[model samples]
Target: MTRIFSALVIGLIFGAGIALSGMANPAKVLNFFDVAGSWDPSLAFVMGGALVVTAIGYTFVLKRKAPVFDRLFHLPTRRDIDRPLLAGSAVFGIGWGITGFCPGGAIPALGLGYSDAWVFVGSMVAGIALARLARHTMAARAAGKAV
Candidate 1:
């Protein structure tokens, strides 16, 4: 229950921050990407601040033996980038550049009644489903089974 409550509070704060910072605005994000054109460096500062805070928070949290709500830290063990990672990252970057709405930004934008956000979020969900299906198919083929 404590974990759940903490998560709720954290999520609310994050969403509010995203909204307030104009990160939920697709045009702002697109402008940030337009480096050779009328580039907006403001989002870079926001990202840098987030990075600093996250680095400090991680340093403290990781020094502990376990998480506050769990017995052990749930961390990703993979260190090597593979084909799937590269492919997925490229796809994500392309989508983000075109739509100016990554998953994190788009969700909050949805709450603010943006139609583009709705479309982006819906497409993101469909992409996730398609990726999962592809993974299952690949796994089945690797095991010499029909998917």
Candidate 2:
């Protein structure tokens, strides 16, 4: 229950940050990709600032044995570049390029009363469901083969 509340509070802070940053505007994000026409470098600055802050946070957080809310520090174990990773990255890049609404930004953009965010979020949810189903089917096949 505490963990859930902490997550909710953190998520709200993240959403508020996104909203305040003007990143909730798809046009602002899309313009960052348009190097030939009306390119905006503000996104790059924002990314750099985030990177700096994250680096500082990581420096402090990693020094701790465990997280404040959790007993263990949850981190990615996989380091190797695999087919699934590459495919997922490509898909993510394509989606971002086309829609300019990332999962993080899209959630906050919902508060702006834009139908575009709704469509993107709905599609994202469908994609996530399909991915989970496919992964489950693949795992079942692998297990059956092993038997």
Q: What's each prediction's clash count?
A: 0, 0
Tens digits of per-residue lDDT, candidate 1, 51-130, equal 99999999999999999899999999999999999999999999999999988899899999989998899889999999
Most TM-score-accurate candidate: 1
Candidate 1: pairs in clash: none
Candidate with maximal lDDT:
1
Alpha carbon lDDT at 77, candidate 2: 96
TM-scores of all predicted structures: 0.96, 0.92
lDDT of the structure predicted as candidate 2? 0.91
Write out the backbone clash pairs for model 2: none
Q: Least accurate stretch of 10 residues (summed lDDT) in model 2?
A: 138-147
**Tens-digit per-residue lDDT, 16-129, candidate 2:** 888888888999999999999999998898889889999999999999999998799999998999999999999988998899999989999998786899999999999999
TM-score of 1: 0.96
Off by over 4 Å in 2: 145-147
